[model samples]
Target: MNFPTKLKKLREEKKLKQQDVADKLGIARTTYASYEQGKREPDHATLVKIADFFGVSLDFLLRDENEDFQDKIFEDEAKRILKDPKTFLAARDGEITPEILDAALEIITEQLKEGRKKKSD
Candidate 1:
């Protein structure tokens, strides 16, 4: 996602009102709204503040908005499934359906992101 859309999403994901972020950034509500609307961009310092406030790296917040990023998992996460009896059976045979695998992947992804966030903090 682009900066504008991502900014809006991050705010919503945090359940923060625009004014809440504005207050935190010490900026006007209108200015923050403009950033989300793509009408204005935050300067370098403000951008860094936004990144810090959201607990995300500046690169993560400013990458190409149009880039298509597919879901990725760590090699260890894949190995984890292979080592688990439930998944080992499925991997060796056809015991586990694709739905189960997908659900496992999603759960693992959430766990990994949470772990990284906590470690960063």
Candidate 2:
């Protein structure tokens, strides 16, 4: 996908609205919408802001590759969470409590167990 499409997809995946992205970038919602629609390109500074806001590399945002980006994306996400712990927590809307993490781990463990059983079978 192109940059605009990628941008839109990422924003949506993060459960963010266009206005939220515009507010973060200090741009008008219409301008941000234009960017998502591929009508206008963002300047370098705006590009940097977008990259940082999304916790992604500019290269990842601009590229169409499926390999090697996952690690960079994870690193960027970790950095972003470290940079703004409150926002990170807020983004989860209280859904990521310790109990949730524990439950998720339990689910993963069960899945692994099932995978191993299948392999043995």
Error of 1 at 92 (Å): 42
Give, for candidate 1, the lowest lDDT window spanning 10 residues.
Answer: 68-77
Model 1 misplacement above 4 A:
65-121
- The positional error of residue 70 in candidate 2, measured at the CA in angstroms, is 6.6
Best by lDDT: 2
**All candidates: TM-score:** 0.55, 0.59
Which pairs of residues clash in candidate 1, taking residues 3 or more apart in a chain or in different chains? none
Cα deviation at 65, candidate 2, in Å, is 2.9
Report the Cα lDDT for residue 108, model 1.
74
Q: Per-residue lDDT of 1-121 in model 2, one digit per residue for the tens?
A: 6788888977886789999999989999999999999999999999999986776678888886666543445555554455665775565453343433454455567879999999999
